[model samples]
Target: MAGHATVPSSPEPSSLRALPPSAKLVVKTLEYEGRLTQAELVESTRLPDRTVRYALRELEDEDLVTSRISFADARQRVYSLTTAES
Candidate 1:
């Protein structure tokens, strides 16, 4: 411990801030649209299907978004935010 240099602790931004632009857009879309299917996200966000899918995967990895089998279509999943930012 004596040889180690001490670094000052700084207040870091929310985990949300560290997300990629696509992920942020996906989060915002979910915030306004509530739960939506992947296809719906593509329509709402105007992002490519592959881009939307990647964004959703990133969101899920961060535990910022959650998904479940859609009631309307079991083959598709509806995604929503798991946490609210103050």
Candidate 2:
């Protein structure tokens, strides 16, 4: 460990830190509002639907976000952060 640098207990934060700005905004929105549908995320974040979709995909790829069928509407999916951190 002579030349080793310190590391965070969880790698998700660092992984999140490397994500695109749009993805970060989506994460922030979820953190503040908890779970929300794609449309709700767009309305809350004020990001375009396509951008939100892309960001959600990015977050999902990194395992930072999870989505499930919305109970209110099966056509939509509710999204939330996988961890406490963004």
Candidate 3:
């Protein structure tokens, strides 16, 4: 251990582990895709709108994801992972 760097147990919390698989997938998608609308998330994840909505809600509840009104389309919302901020 003298020459080796220490590693943390986990980057994520136990609460994340309790979330549904769909929520996890949404998180990953946002991490890679940056920000996306609900319809775009459906296309990227190939999941139904209802599933994506539920996942987004769960992510929001966990404070893992953030959303804002889309400048391009005021009626739609854009979502992104909070951790992505630099």
Candidate 4:
């Protein structure tokens, strides 16, 4: 019988290290919930509004998350993990 090759079971350390703890939390929330508004993200992460906004901005800059005006309320903005990140 031929032996099967073993596959790596974990993500690269560099990839994990690149994300800050808050960013990780935000990503996880978005991934689990599909889509969320900025307020919702703040609630979900239990983070301060400034922290949530900072994380969202960093994620957006990294192309990890995308945002657009909410159809239900133009005054509000919705956010979600990008397809590549998801």
Candidate 5:
């Protein structure tokens, strides 16, 4: 924990207000589903591939989500809400 930076315990309304609707949907999906891959997010959120990708990038920029390589498939990445945001 030494080198890790702490985020606010709750999301800031101003920040969330600035995000696109797709990004908000992605966040809600992750919150409900725990964690999911890009494909899963698309399935769960009914969002297009490109939109999911864009949303993920936006979430990452806000430090609201983090990604890790899937253990079952090296080619896939799974995403989840960060502890602070979760």
Candidate 6:
């Protein structure tokens, strides 16, 4: 009699699936530009205000981005990548 060998299932890769293309672009922009206002992100990304806002929110949730009120303009908020992220 022959016995079958048991096989273990492999776990999915976590780092492999990161931010989408647009989100990745947003992260890179923030990483290179330091801190940028919403308008600045729109200009740099050429994306609509709503789209930028959504992307920013997602990045924030991932701890890859952060925002704060601008000293120059309290009405405007500046966004930047987290120090922990590369």
- What lDDT score is found at residue 82 in candidate 4? 73
Instruction: Give the TM-score (vs. native) of candidate 4.
Output: 0.76
Work out candidate 2's RMSD over C-alphas: 9.3
How would you encode candidate 4's per-residue C-alpha lDDT over 24-84 as one tens digit per residue?
7887787777678989999999999899898888878877788989999999999876763
* Candidate ranking (lDDT, best to worst): 2, 5, 3, 1, 4, 6
lDDT of 1 by residue, 1-86 (tens): 79643432221238778778998898878876677899999999999999999999998888788899999999999988775422
Clashes of each: 0, 0, 0, 0, 0, 0
Tens digit of lDDT per residue, candidate 6, span 1-86?
Answer: 25633322211225215756677777767756667898999999999888888888887887667788999999999887676233
In candidate 1, the residue pairs with backbone N, CA or C atoms under 3 Å apart (3 or more residues apart, or in different chains) clash, namely none
Better of 1 and 4 by TM-score: 1
Worst 10 residues of 3 by lDDT: 3-12
For model 1, the stretches where C-alpha displacement exceeds 4 angstroms are 1-13, 84-86
Candidate 6 residue 63 C-alpha distance from true site, Å: 0.8
lDDT per residue, candidate 3, 1-86, as tens digits?
A: 69653332221667679899888888777766678999999999999999999999988888788899999999999998776642
Q: What is the lDDT of candidate 5?
A: 0.84
- What is the Cα-based lDDT of residue 81 in candidate 6? 68
* lDDT against the true structure, each candidate: 0.80, 0.84, 0.81, 0.76, 0.84, 0.72
Give the winner by lDDT: 2 or 4. Answer: 2
Q: Which residue pairs does candidate 3 place in steric collision? A: none
Which of the two, 5 or 6, has more TM-score?
5
> Candidate 5: which pairs clash?
none
Residue 8 Cα positional deviation in candidate 4, in Å, after optimal superposition: 21
List residue ranges in candidate 2 displaced over 4 A. 1-11, 84-86
lDDT of 2 by residue, 13-62 (tens): 67888888999999888876778999999999999999999999998998
- Model 2, global lDDT: 0.84
Please say which candidate is ahead in lDDT: 2 or 6: 2
